[model samples]
Target: MKAARGSVVSKKGVPWGTIISVVAVVALAAVVVTYYLVQSAPKRALASWAPTADNPDPSLNIPGIVTGQYQASVHILPTERVAYDHSPPYGGPHDGYWAACNGVVYPVAVRTENMVHSLEHGAVWIAYNPDQVSGDALNTLKSKVEGKPYTMMSPYPGLDSAVSLQSWGHQLKVGSATDERIDQFITALRTNQNTYPEVGASCDALGAGAFDPDNPPPFDPTPPGPDAKPMDYQGSAGTQQDTGMPSSAPTS
Candidate 1:
C-alpha cells in the first residue's frame, strides 16, 4: 500500500512507532530543559542581590570590617566542645565533627559546635526559629537553601532572631524570610575561601557521626552559664574577653 502524502510514516511504512519515538525524545528534552531552569532560577535571583562594591578576597587576609554591616572575627582552640556565646555560633572552638554542608537542610536543630566546623570549611549556615518562621516564609527560605552546595539550614530553637545567617566569623539576623540580606549573605560567603580558617576542605565526607539528618544533634538552646566561654576569644583561653549573652527564649 502507498503511504499518504504528507503523512508521518517513514519510507519503510512504520507509522506509529517512529512518531511515538520522536515525540518521546522531544518530551524528554523538554523535561531536561525544565529541570535546568528550575534549578538555576534561585541562583539567578540571588545574583541580582550581590553587592556592587568590590568584595575583598576573604581567603587573603580575612578582613575585619566591623563598622556597620560587618562583625568582629573570632578564633579559638579546637576544643572537643564549647559553650559558644552566640546561639548559632558565628566562629569559635568547635567539635572535630562538622555537620554535612553539601546542601543539606536539616529538619531538626543541629549542634552549634559541629556547625562551627562547617563554617571553617566555608559553608554558610542558615538558622531559623521554628516558632517564628512558618508557612510561606519557611518554604521561601528552603528554596534558597535546598540543593545549594556548601550551605546548610536548620532550626535554632531559641534563636535570637527569627532568622540568622552565619559564615566563618560573620552573622546577620533578619526579622523575616523576605529580608534581602538572606540572598546577599549566601552570595557573599558560600565557599568563600578567604574568610574561613580552613578553606578548600571537603564539606562532604566529614565524620559519619557528625551529622545524620534523620537524627541531627539537638541544639543547646539554653542560655550559656556564667562560665561559658566568650565568643571573641582570639586563639587562646586567656584572651576570651567576657561579653554579653543573648537571653534564652522558649523553643518552638
Candidate 2:
C-alpha cells in the first residue's frame, strides 16, 4: 500500500546464514556416521567368525594355514632352548615362564622358549622379518597387536617370510603385512577355548626377573647347539610347578 514519503519498508526474505549453518552441521554429521560405520565393519565381520562347536577352528578355513598337534605341559628350564621344528615355532616344549603377550610389541626379538609359552596361553605371536618389513607395513601389523589382549609382535631376525603369525599349533606366513589372513588367523585362534591348552591363562608378565617385557630375553639367532633339547623332551623336574610363577633369574 502507498505510504507517506520517507516511510521505511519492511521485507521478509530467506535466512541464508541460518540455512548455511544448518546444512554444514548436517554434512558434518553424515561424514562422522560414515566414518564410524566403515571403521567398525571389519570388527563386526570378525565377530561372526568366532570359534563354534560346528566350526571349531575358523582359521582352518583360511587358505595357507598350517596346523600342528604339539603336546602341552612340556616345560624347559630358562637356561635351555628348543631345536624347534619351525623357524618360528608355533608350539612345542618351551620355557616355564611366558612372554608378556598382553598386546606387547617387543622391540627386540624375544626368547623363543618364552614366546612359545605365550602361545600355549592362547596368545597370537606376530613375527615379522625386520629386513623385509618396515615403515607403513610394520605399522600396519603393530595396529593389530598393540593394545589387544593375547597378542604380541616382534622382529624375527632371520624369518623366511615377511610376516609369520603363530598361535599355539597354528601358523600362517604371508608375504605382506596387510594380508587379510593375518586378522582371520588371530580372530579364530587367539584365546579360542577349543584350540589352546591353557585356557584363561594370564598373558601378563610373570614379573621382573622371570619374564620382563621391558627387558625381555633376546632372541638367539645361532643354531640350537648339539645340547639343545629335543621337541619331545619331557620338562625338567619341578619346571611344571613353576608355570605362571616368577623366577629369581630372567628367562633366556
Q: Evaluated with TM-score, which candidate comes out highest?
A: 2
Q: Give the TM-score of candidate 1.
A: 0.62
Clash pairs, candidate 2, are none
Prediction 1 global C-alpha lDDT: 0.67
Model 2 steric clash total: 0
Question: Where does the lowest 10-residue lDDT sum fall in candidate 1?
Answer: 243-252
For model 2, give the 10-residue run with minimal summed lDDT. Answer: 4-13
The pairs that clash in candidate 1 are 58-194, 58-195, 59-194
Q: Give TM-scores for every candidate, taking all chains together and pairing residue i with residue i.
A: 0.62, 0.83
Clash number for every model?
Answer: 3, 0
lDDT of 2 by residue, 91-163 (tens): 9999888899999988899999999999999999999999999999999999999999999999999999999
